[model samples]
Target: MADLTFTKSTGLLAWPAAGGQWSARSGPFGLGALPSGVYAVGRNEVTDYTTSICAAFQDGTGNGFFVPIYPGFSTTRGSIGGRLGIHPDGNVPGTAGCIGITEHDASSFHDAISNTPANVSLTIEVR
Candidate 1:
């Protein structure tokens, strides 16, 4: 699995790299600034969202990146939470509850976590 950190304010997805440094990519998350301290995403297994608005992404995955956020929904998000994932914001303005990566780097982001052979689960902290 991969350990990642996402900054909601800036829509930056960051992760530790081979050395002691961190690598990151920027994009948009959520249709608007929903709220902070929403919830942590325990995501595993990156999949391609073929039906997504950005499904046209030319990533090797053949579509857009779609990693299901664990718990499926957030209890921290009031009474009813929404479906969430990590995908590329290709065709639209922004996302609903999912974090979006730029279309250009969707594949790299997909490989970054999907290719790792260390852990069983991927946990991402949204700051």
Candidate 2:
């Protein structure tokens, strides 16, 4: 079976009014169902100042997978790296490094985030 994990790995938590799962800011958000396999999401929650966002997964001891940052939201062939990766351009108004999707596997990456009260949520799936 395929498992999906959502995470809010940065900036501010953009949630709804009633308080529920999180979503991305403005701009183009990526959406897709990942391949059937084990994956993990990680990010540093925004507190005071200074923050870095990255997503990676390790299947086994030696096998490690690193998420790539898609440039210009281009889905063209012969790009930088293989495999579908999420691409973030710019958020509402004028913000950078916001959440966005690229591959079909990243459809649920924002489901774990909460925007309202400002809270980060991380979801993980094994097998």
Q: Which stretches in model 2 have alpha-carbon errors above 4 Å? A: 1-19, 23-33, 44-122
Instruction: Report the lDDT of model 1 for residue 11.
Output: 60
RMSD (Cα, Å) of model 1: 5.2
For 1-127, candidate 2 gives per-residue lDDT tens digits of: 2123334333222223324333322222223232222233232331111113322221112122223322222334214224333233222221122233322232233333212134332333211
TM-score of each: 0.62, 0.21
Per-residue lDDT of model 1, residues 3-82, tens digit only: 66667666677767611222233233433443444344444456644545345233334466566564323444323455
RMSD per model, one decimal: 5.2, 14.0
Error of 1 at 66 (Å): 0.4
Global lDDT of each model? 0.53, 0.28
Candidate 2: C-alpha lDDT: 0.28
